[model samples]
Target: MSLKAWAAKHYARRVVQSDARWMAQPHQTQEAVFKKLIRQAKNTAFGKDHDFASIKSPQDFRERVPVRDYEQLRNYVERIVAGEEDVLWPGRPKYFAKTSGTTSGSKFIPITSISMKEQVRASRRALLHYIHESGNTEFVNGKMIFLQGSPVLEKKGGIYYGRLSGISAHYLPAYLQTNRLPSWETNCIEDWETKVDAVVEETIRADMRVIAGIPSWVQMYFERLQSAGSKRVGDLFPNFSLFVYGGVNYEPYRAKFESLIGRSVDSVELFPASEGFFAFQNQQDDPGLLLLLDAGIYYEFIPADQFFDDNPPRLGLEEVVLGKDYALILSTNAGLWGYNIGDTVRFVSKDPYKVVVSGRIKHFISAFGEHVIAKEVEQAIQEGIQAFPARVNEFTVSPQTAPEEGELPYHEWLIEFDQEPEDLKGFAAEMDKSMQEQNSYYKDLIEGKILQPLKITTIQAGGFDAFMKSIGKLGGQNKVKRLANDRSTADPLSAFKTT
Candidate 1:
């Protein structure tokens, strides 16, 4: 066997042995892990302020440390940025992962040495589990390319700041780096258009066996490769077999990606954020990702219907019920205490807990009390696309509440299509019908004439791309919000209208 293949098999065997005990009794494992974290950080400033010494259990921990958003935790993070010791975690954070904010320009999330190690460990476990499950070591034997952000981190206040992907690239083990494609210089190019060209030039001829990135960016790279005289991705890299993706739902882009590659490729989805590496797809047969219970993060769930309530009940791992949508809350070794990361998820399994990301808390559309979410919209679009002879490149939706005096409010859809439908009006009607069937509130609104049918506006081929680039959020983990509560996102998209 090849050296890389042999190493992969050995790693997979070790992961299986290590993971068996935890999977057998996940509840006990999670409880013990949570207690260990509490004891470790009880002396920190945040812990002291919240009376962590008095906390005895999950109930006590919740009562002591109230759930907080980024804005609510800004003060503590700022103190850490000013070089305070033991402000949140034991020592100063190693780096600050910068993500786009709603009101704030950018959010700087702390990353400690312990949290960094956990991130690396969780990622490695995910790959090892995949290898053990599939019995595929050829991927590890060949080159793997991860299309990440610029690795040249920017320093601020004695701490480095960059995209989470960029920060993660810095932590890749030396052994794996030897077989990874795309040189450091190519990865450090800030401009995405330039960076993609450099990546293609450097790795097109390499024996690429695995590729990882956000679906949209990776699709863009595949298109670039196809344009360079390659009929399909497999034509350029015959051994390419695994595709790892996260940051957005892959369903909408699945067909497009498969079409680009000229065949189906095994894929693994991950639920990672700037806050922490949460979960990853562990089994090939199951769609849900296995929750990292023993990772340095303690998890809590609040029902989505009650998330905005004045006193939403928090549920621990033992309290969660399968198939219910809940907004995820975290208390991590990174020093975040009951932090609400705004992502919603649904539990799919109990024994070895598994979950599927439902949507984002802020990305819902409930202006008229329809309570529509990203999942609903995505499903509606998927159904609607079936009646058409085209493919959706990208799309976003918003409520049009500012109708004329006699008219009712309605939903507006802005879409950029790679191929146009033969009958535009039929396609729009199909989408509206699908949505009405899925949401009782929406159906009621239509029956009562409180809202008009959804309006569809087609944009030029590269309209969404142009908008993202205009806002300096064109590439690498950045995605357009699929649904907006207001016209803030949809209004700007109209500027790129094709007709």
Candidate 2:
């Protein structure tokens, strides 16, 4: 280990680790409430899709609609370019979320008014759940912190739709207008530097109570909160009760956030996007049961096994199997009528139709049946280092063929350790062991000698940052992407950048 790195580690251990605060309430299991919630979602969303005629079962609806992916939505977006109001949302949209694109440059997703209302309703339900989880009600007393994309109502230079899909500035909550740090919309820049700076200034100034936004953005906000430590929760906003987040998994991030902030903050999860606010993590135990906003979009699940298969099976709400994985499809108040949002999830156990987020359907490497989902990868890393302690800032895994002929696809991991590993090879093997434990498919593949050996590479601090910069994605919103799933090696740099 470098002397400098070792020194930094000891200092951090004393300051951050020793004083870390973790506050969690046992997740609540409100089966009856959640079942009523899902039923409401069915009636509101499906009711409209069937022309206000009540659809009794998830099976009845599934027979008529076919399963689809994000590509199908992109085609609808193209039609929107042709000046067709018949986009996903029914009436005029609030605006698109303008999410950073994966395949192409950027996608201008449409968010109709009904969709926006449905989405907002989901947010409200999430808030109620947060209150239930935290066992507090301070939100009514203080400013709620909403860390969101601040794109405005300005028209796109080109004919095509830009960030503001169909929404206007009038949609922002009235309380936030005067409360916003930067009074003008001009401060909203696509650049990370200006955006983070402006956002940091706002959090400091507002001393926001109920913090909410994308998990990645919230991570950046917490970093700023750690740096700007003078503002105490009580001093800044006495009523501060919840720290709501969504858009990505929070498991790998939870420990770091606790250490940096030096306090235990409660959180709520929302399922908001350009499409609509469809669900909310209203129950603590039900991290993924998503309380469907009965007022917004109609929700359905397609069996995960049917994905990318010749004959896909679309399951109605009733036909959904408990303790199984499924991909989500939605029909909402927004013009998006029966659209699939390209997200996959699993049912942990259900009475109230509760489930845990398994992982994104597309975001994994299981071609030869290794079956490594995003959550499994995160959990394996956590399990591998339970002995004593080992700090990991970030890690990524890519499936690839060994750098030789006749080689099968192996798991390659690039991790930034807080300190050097005592036995790099052992750590990788230990991680593999953990992988085999959590996922049976991977265990079988490994035992069968089909999947290649697990490979590990150490990196200096800020290795991930350097990689993000190379891809022109600096600061917030840049996520860890699994670049390869098979023998394909289109861009090696896409996996992880090195010195």
Candidate 3:
């Protein structure tokens, strides 16, 4: 083998060894513990349906409450955002988490006292399991990194479609107040650059150890850190113990993160959402533990094909089977019952309900883990095109595969523009480069020859707006859906000429 190839192999083996350090936490009593909470949540939601609130004789919460989408929540969300009380929650909520979903633009979810209590405590409890990764997690008092987005500062105090800004502002520990991000990011300034700068300053000033947030934003933080003369995180915070993240797959960011940080810190996958703090990666090397917020909310898992069913299989805490992929349904303390959050995950084991996010069954690409999820791929494509001088007025990503001539399946981007691409060829090449650099799985897949390289297709201006208009999704709360996994918008790239 060539020396470079041997070195690459050596490095891959080592990283795998490091990743393999994670071990599953034993689930001796977690099922019984979480099930009781599920029963109580059901009782709280609708006074129980067909023994639904019975721990000994459980019921699927779905039978009691039909699934309601955000459209059903339009009035309720407005009321909460307007700072009024409504059926969105049982009572006046304490806070609101503005998270965006695949189909929706901005979701201003209500955070009730009960739901907050459930989410916060469950988040803390999940940390206890993260201790397994630390080799000594209890006493992990060190600098941390929170790679989160700038907070959204709206006068209405309504929840919207961003994650870090409002939620972390309210929940950051008092001890970490000095470490909190500046108010400018959370204020009403509309400039993305200004907001990024404020957060970048806070990250640099704190000498943080534990980093958290979406991988893209975190990478921006690290890039800014490099410009500020701090390349390795070890140089800034030798006491760094953990790197926490969620929102998208981590494999792509791993290499870049490691390269930037210089040392391997325990990476934790926290399954938190605007609605609830779901599951967490408990072990350092292994998959995480789903510490079901036993008290915070009740959960229902519907099979993928049965989502539209009059009688869908809805499994509750005690009854949820292991190794099955299910669409997660939640009934939160904020008064959302039988709410489908639009993410699909599978139970790896259930004594403690260990699970993995399989994919967004609705928003994800149908390809093998190429994972062209809507929001993320859109963002990545945006970032990818930053290197190009062209003004990207519109773009769409769709699944494409080889023709009868026979080639691998891949993702292709059809971008529409105002200014002609300064370097159309360059942008396409750079787009794939940026994506590969960001996701390690994509890199491994590419290296293993699992996928044909991601391809970009450019089109005339106004095309994106035309497409969005066709879908009746024009303007403020609605953006054109990019990164479709199916052949809905255009034919799957099967017939396209291989680039």
lDDT by residue (tens digit), candidate 2, 1-499: 5443344344444432221221011112222322333344443333344433444444554554455555656766665555555334333344555667667757667655555565554554455445444545545445555554444554332232333312423455564465333344423566765676666666565646666665555666666665665653344454555677766667666656555555667766655556666455655655665535244445667776667788777655556776677787776554454567766667654444555666677777876766577777877777665642466666677776545687766787777665545776777777888888888888888788888667776656666656666667665444666334753322334454445
Error of 3 at 201 (Å): 4.0
Residue lDDT tens for model 3, 1-499: 5443344345445543443332233222334434544544444323343344443432444444577766666666666666654444444566656655446576667666666666666555445445433434322344444444444534445433344344554666565555434453433344434545555666565646566666655655566667775457557656666676776666535645666778777777878776777777766667744545445555667886566677787776556666656788876656666678887787786544578776565766647675444435644655554666554444567766653367877777776544555676777777777767756677777788877777766564445444544665432223344557666765522232223
Model 2 ranges off by over 4 Å: 1-64, 73-76, 85-94, 100-105, 154-172, 175-187, 224-241, 404-409, 418-426, 475-478, 482-499
Q: What is the lDDT of residue 61 in candidate 2?
A: 49
Query: Model 3 lDDT vs. the true structure?
Result: 0.58
How do these models rank on lDDT, best leading?
A: 1, 3, 2
Per-model CA lDDT versus the true structure: 0.88, 0.57, 0.58
Q: What are the TM-scores, per candidate, against the unseen true structure?
A: 0.96, 0.76, 0.63
lDDT of 3 at 229: 59
Q: Which one is best on TM-score?
A: 1
Judged by lDDT relative to the true structure, which candidate is superior, 1 or 3? 1
Candidate 1 residues 1-499, lDDT tens each?
A: 7887888889899988888888888888878878988998899999899988888899999888888999999999999888888988898899999988777778999998889899888888888888898989888778999999888888867999998899999989888888887998889999998989888998888999999998888988998998874579988888999999898888778777777888888998888888999999998889898998888898999999899999999999888999888999999989998999999999999868999988888889999999988878888888777888567788899999997788889999998877778998898899899999988999999889989999888999888888999888888889889998999888888999986
